[model samples]
Target chain A: MTDATDFAGSSREKWTGFSANQYFICLKGILVREWLRYLSQKERFVSSLVRPLLWLFIFAAGFRQVLGVSIIPPYETYVLYEVYITPGLCGMILLFSGMQSSLSMVYDREMGNMRILLVSPFPRWYLLVSKLLAGVGVSLLQVYAFLAIAWFWDVRAPVAGYFLILPALFFAGLMLGALGMLLSSLVKQLENFAGIMNFVIFPMYFASSALYPLWRVQESSPLLYKICLLNPFTYAVELIRFAFYARIEWTSLVVVLAVTLALLGAAILAYNPARGLTVRKQDMGGSQ
Target chain B: MKLQSRSPETPRTDERAAVAALELASISYNYGQRKALDDVSFSIEPARFTVLLGLNGAGKTTLFSLVSHLFSPRTGRIRVFGQDIDRNSGQALRRLGIVFQARTLDLDLTVRQNLLYHAALHGIGTRVARQRIDELLHAIDLTDRIEEKVRGLSGGQVRRVEIIRALLHRPSLLLLDEATVGLDIKSRATILKDIRALVERDGISVLWATHLIDEVGQADQVLVLDKGKLVADGPVATILSSTGTETINQAFSKLTGITDMNVRGGRP
Candidate 1:
């Protein structure tokens, strides 16, 4: 209710203040809010690292005697199956973590909070992409933790392999992240999502090079080798496999990029408000 | 329908039509062949509080669903501020906010976190959104309970949270679908007062969808949907006069032809 002069100088000051304040807020949003969510979920952090450690410990011990990993291009000397599968195992960790985060979407929807999210004014794509990015960030942390464990086990990659893995991990994470979004939007109920783990994930993982190389699988059965090569999970494991050896595999990169794009497209189609799975009734209020 | 033009000097050109913030024309929806909203047509005028009254099986929720774009009608179109909703859903929806009959909130997060998540999704910047969150907490009387998880909130408090959440975007058109289902009179009055204040102070258009006759009055406009059709539309007193009834309770029964509607019994 003050006069004209009081408003004039304040309006000038407010304009510059808004511009400065907005950039600072956006920075805080991505780093503090998104990154801090992972730090808060202490159990998720622990479990992501634990599942891979179990595989490296007991499963690798049992399989090391039976499985004979022949000469791989990256390995000059004959390495044990234990050393051969570490990269694939790391990829398995990222793959499972991505799908695990995606599977949680149905639970969030059933609990009713997803509705509050969709109704917001932001373009729906940004909201989802940011959430996916946060999931990727979590996957990256778990991947590093797994690598640290491998180093402790006396099975180590080259010093430069870690730097090379950054981009490889990024592509693999995007591909898996996209798959998670696709599964989340398609699955209606939280209970129904168990199929994603058992049907979608396990087959994709087993069919890939995570356990054995494509050449070894081909030696056993050409049909199994073909199945493994066709799997998006194969590219995920192969990409990580090559990355661990500090080598580049162009074919794996192409396959991972293409699958990532395709999955993201499918997820967006399934989530589009018009006829997508999101239109279904979301049961949100309390039972009481 | 009366249109209110804004002053020439202001850049806000879209502020037109004080009489009906949202208008629907011959809108119809179906589940394959079975009609959900049967050739329904209605207009919700601006500033005047309106209540959509109906029975349980009537198309009250269906009508609200179509209006809110949860499910669009297969036939006809919906308009908000003279612009067709489908053609400009982003702009139209950005200008409108809704709270469903069922509460839609994240139970895992704290009330403050939940609101902040919504603000980020709504594209509200961090600083302004933070300030808005504080203001909304004060307005909804949840300032003290901001840090508490939503899983622990009382039913009435949860309901209040949902209402305030809907109003976060400062929508020109606010849709409340069965907002006061099981609340006591005190909670109900607070929500009603908040909505009333929105209309008086912010010029926000509200469509209060409820089956209860006590919620709507003689002065307010009322639309009765019986069996997926727009049964009657006008001021409560005017519409009631056609049935030769004084109170909305008697008028609702007379107009919709419900003779055996007992207070405690199930809806037929």
Candidate 2:
């Protein structure tokens, strides 16, 4: 065996470089751990699917007669209420997942697991991004599960549309997940999670085109329609809605990508140890 | 057995010029208006067992947070070996491992899974990680519990697993903040003995933070922190001799002016 001194020297030299392989392995670690945790909490999986399915079945069923759909860019003919709301429900899954990821972030911080990731040799931004991607990965699974169930309920899209929707869901998931990451940094304690739901989740979901088309909102209240246009969740649903029919909404696509980048950038700054939310929490000895 | 250690590779041609295992110069941190660490400064020599003695709020955890890069100091700098933590955090943190005061293991994950996750975070490949995990579990005598979920393990067993997790990447400096706080006597002794053996056999540098006076050995180097200020830093004998105290307990009491050391360590 090598001398202890010689071994330390060689090992330090070996591990210091930030190679592509190392970054990839780190990401794999985060993803696998997330998947393991997600798999273990079977209730979380069931709930994610259940919430969307309830909206598709019960909520859309009740609204079908009152909310008749007109031909939209993604639709050649008038579609059923359930079919129009399927993508919105997918957006709902992504949105809730983003919030759920935020909740987990708070739990991790309070529980001290966040310390492990923060202290790793990888760059902090990369670690946060990897975590964001992990949440997005889980959201994609939930979205697909919801879509599969929707298909059995007579809400089927084109076969090619199914394949095309993956990228759209992925990008939308990124945007919503980034928003969640930013909210996690802003929320100091786990007890404040209700505030997130009331202030962020509900407002984003309700003011978006997730339930009714923007034109329908424009007819009812032009101000609410303007708010929907401004909501990133609106773009997320529109992007998914367009992709579900094998069409692309370039405006929604651009909005989703740009908002993802902006929110992700903000989340990274908020998590920065020296100047952001973490520093304030540390100032209070992390008690808050 | 292969274990993590440090190389005193920087020759002491001039002692001042040699790279210390860790160096903190005029580091201060604040909690809003309240000061947590008040312009503290100290350094640990490589391959030494250094005890950081402090009462419940002595700012030891705050210092550890700075060293781990969890929170940057409001003023001053921290360096591990020769790498600055703020400017070159990746290189600095790559050489440091920490066992926090709180339990960091994912309770739902098995011991092997938790360690594998940590190993991958440090960029270790799977095969190498598995080999390291096996060797560490064997060394810690927790090999049989490798497949057991962390929640099922005893407190001492969980801590042992955490120690292994910290060592997976073979860090040169290991920091443990109240690592034995809630353990039984036997477990505490066993953990301390194991850590001491690492310093003796593997030549690993350690900064052990504890309020328990009994945990500090007479010959070990010590840093006594008082209310966020570093009050005393030297060998145990040096501190005792300087303060004209007979024991480390008396010396610590004299340095920090805490008369009731017995409260922290029953026999002190």
Candidate 3:
């Protein structure tokens, strides 16, 4: 025991201090881990792109002849369906990426690594935010990769719009990522995630203005248009769509921002140790 | 039954200095209608190895969760080194380290990466984190395995890495919740020896939670819980003597009023 004290005392002096810099270190570690995981799983990159490209090339090409899209603000002339849906596909990339990150969060919780993150002295909000930021970072990379592919496919945004869209992409990614975080807190098991993709991912994508313009939906059915207007995913897609044209979609921006903040607040509450959705039956011994 | 007196070295006086490394005062937790811990109260001294002995569903994990702030007690207060866990959780948690009952390492990550990430969370700089990691790995005789991914490591090896991850920030109090649950006898013994050595040599207070009676030593302090209630708490010899039993197994059976072999098996 004396030896233990002696060793600790001497050893303690070599590395013993805490500072704000550690926050960045933690954030860096999280981002690096995400990057490493992304790098290792080349299939994820391919899959993420494949979904959007399928929509752009296959669905867009097929719909081009069938659908008549009026010249949207960003487009000076009547555009091909592929050109119109490119930004929507960008939104899709973010949506799936966000959900994928949350899937990992659920996995982390089940596997006990989430406990490691929660136990850190930092505020839970900070940890959750870091996770969101890392997810957003990854999702943004995927978005740009998709965009670069689109560029080669002759669906080019203005050169400046490509750079200008970064902030829009970030905010959209954050909102979707935050929503995913909230869902992860509510979801108790991995088996339930497939249900989320079905109920959340598919509905949000199809019901929103991602595929067809809201007016077109209104012309076909006013009720579906009303639902599309209410869907936050609509705003996310609109934000990206407008960004690609170097145009400001204030309504979309405001809606996405509001949804992001609300979902973020709800997520923090859901993850709260005292009264959050994370309170589990296993944690409390039989209580759900 | 006459309760034995406190050890002479036990600091029970000077209220401020004797606040204990960890303390739970009237702590109670519930899962909706079901009570997980009922008015549990205890305190552990610094530099001592206190074994929290309990059977399955005895609220051991619940208690650990509360202490780690994963779940806050609906009633009562928990303090770490006199810092209130609820009111001052950041400070309290800063002095604490924990290895949960479940496996926590990211299997894809290298040993060094896992530890370094934890170090960064505690706000330890990279340079200092690297130095501490090196020393701890050396201490654990895992210096050569630093670059190896956690998935390649054996269960016992991963547990060792988790322990090292917990200690990287030099937390004053270390908690292990059923850390040896799945390990072989040799691995369990090695871990137990290493942790006990930490207390004896480094003066780091330890709260080792498990149901295994064999893990409790005569010199060690024991806090026994049964069915979410604190049944007995004292030195091992004192608990045995007070119960009028020859061994801890018999004493635990006597205290809990359960004679079933399966209940006393401590297999899980």
> Largest lDDT belongs to which candidate?
2
- What's the number of clashes in each of the models? 4, 1, 6
Question: What would the per-residue lDDT of candidate 2 be over residues A119-209, giving only the tens digit for each residue?
Answer: 9978999999999999999999999998888889989999888999999999999999999999988888889999999999889999999
Query: Global lDDT of each model?
Result: 0.70, 0.85, 0.82
Model 1: residue A264 alpha-carbon error in angstroms: 1.2
Query: Candidate 2: misplaced stretches above 4 Å?
Result: A1-16, A279-288, B1-17, B265-268
lDDT for each residue of candidate 3 in A1-288, tens digit (9 for 90 to 100): 111111111222332333456667778877777787777678999999999999888888888999989986767899888888887899999999999998989988888888888888778898899989999999999999998999998988779989989999999999999999999998998888999999999999999988998889999999999999999999998888888778889999999999999999999988887873675755332311
Give per-residue lDDT, candidate 2, residue A105: 87
For model 1, the superposed segments whose C-alpha errors exceed 4 Å read A1-41, A281-288, B1-19, B62-65, B263-266
Judge candidate 1 at residue A180 and give its lDDT. Answer: 92
Error of 1 at B65 (Å): 4.1
Interface RMSD of each: 8.2, 4.4, 6.5
Give the range of the ten consecutive residues with the poorest summed lDDT in model 3 chain A.
Answer: A1-10
State the weakest 10-residue window (summed lDDT) of model 2 chain B: B7-16
Quick one: how many clashes does candidate 1 have? 4
Chain A TM per candidate, in order of listing:
0.85, 0.93, 0.91
Better of 2 and 3 by TM-score: 2
